[model samples]
Target: MTPETSETTQAPEGHAPSHRADGRRFRWNKVPEITVYFWVIKVLCTTVGETAADLLNEKLGMGLTGVSLLMSALLVAVLVAQFRTRAYRPGVYWLAVALISVVGTLISDNLTDNLGVPLETSTIVFAIGLAVVFAAWYRTERTLSIHHVDTRRRETFYWLAVLFTFALGTAAGDLVAERLDLGYWISAGLFALAIAAVAVAHFALGLNAVWTFWIAYILTRPLGASMGDYLSQPTADGGLGLGTVVTSVLFLAVILGLVIFLAVTRRDVIEQDRITPQVAR
Candidate 1:
């Protein structure tokens, strides 16, 4: 990721500075604040993404291609609703996240299972893709801060980056867990440790917030995916044997309850800058 410019100093973790270096506050951001709730929900979405994709592929009998197309279509529809709204709507935003998670997993799966791409190759490919998106986004917008995701263009860049993160995470996680024979539990532990280190670097070592945030975001996908596999796979396969159906439903239910709570409480809402009408124009 590009270095955050001096003009874009770090705000508190999970909060963005309201005023830019130019003294202009952006319009209301469309994403929720990076609160604990946000991280919990994001991990849950990724877990559901991993297992739910498996469930659909098994039950739908439509093959990976069919499931990918179906999930991708649903993702597009939810994103359309997300874009139509003027501000953050927890339901719409998270629904899009969950759908994108599934779609992202499917993309990685298709490349590996169908096209015979090696996990290492896919991992590198997706990492490059994510970097390109970030570079393009930073070049065009001059900042890659999530707090500034108020405009439609920024939101577009944000989602594209998110999709790549999930895809990259899936590929990398599989490379470590399956290819390297690390096992699901071990893989999950490793990713969790990695995320913890990123946090320490940001809080204790004074790393750039923008870089740490994106790094943690990308790592959560594999962590969550590994967790999902550990819980849902067969006992003989080193899992708890809950099965994908149970695992997916459990995570989805939790996600639904949280989304409803956030919608009602509005705790995660990022308030718009108190700009007057003339200034807003």
Candidate 2:
């Protein structure tokens, strides 16, 4: 996907940065600080989101619509707590993320399985939807950077972009692996290479961090989906046969451990930047 090029600007004046739980000064971004741990945990969350969604759908015997409704309701509850918070609380933010991942997957699954929408169509539609959201967000606030998401409108845009990315990723991943018949391992490797290329372009070739980040963020969902499918699907299906339960449990445990570490250390809290306001205006 091509990254949209737009001039950066901040939200309107009168919005102030927030304080941390420890009373330290910080930005009021509703999301966590971006770091290695952030990306690792994000990927893990995506994997578990895929596997756990599958497990629940199968074990609970809830057809696509039922599972979609249940997860959507749960996501709303989690997002309520997330919206109520003033700062980035790892638990609430990440819980919302994990739930959103599942809900997003279910959304794509419903369109494809229940509604008989084609994967290619779903991928294109979600991509266009995400573009629209980003455009509207930029038109309103003048910046798509998460670092400047201090207002409720920016937070809303952030979550909407995230939801679309998850849905798009789910569709794109299946389009390549299942519809295109590339198999799971090949698909994982392909996405891994793509992510690595994005990193190199950002670090070595001077790509914009915001664009690079959002691009990489979209890719992680598919990467994790492929990895989850590769690990959990049966050997006859070109996977390792680990089963969904085991894969979900393993990834969730890893995510939990990392989140706990982040919570205790508070190392991922983003600092308030003096020049951010100037850019926003």
TM-score of 1: 0.88
Please provide, for model 2 over 1-281, each residue's C-alpha lDDT reduced to its tens digit, 9 standing for 90 to 100. Answer: 11111222232133364444554444356677789999998898899889989999998998878988998999999888887776778888888999989999999999998899999899999999999999998887788988877556678999999999999989988888776788887888899899999999999999999899999999999999989988999999888999999999999988888889988887786656532431233
Evaluate all candidate structures by whole-model CA lDDT and list the values in order: 0.87, 0.83
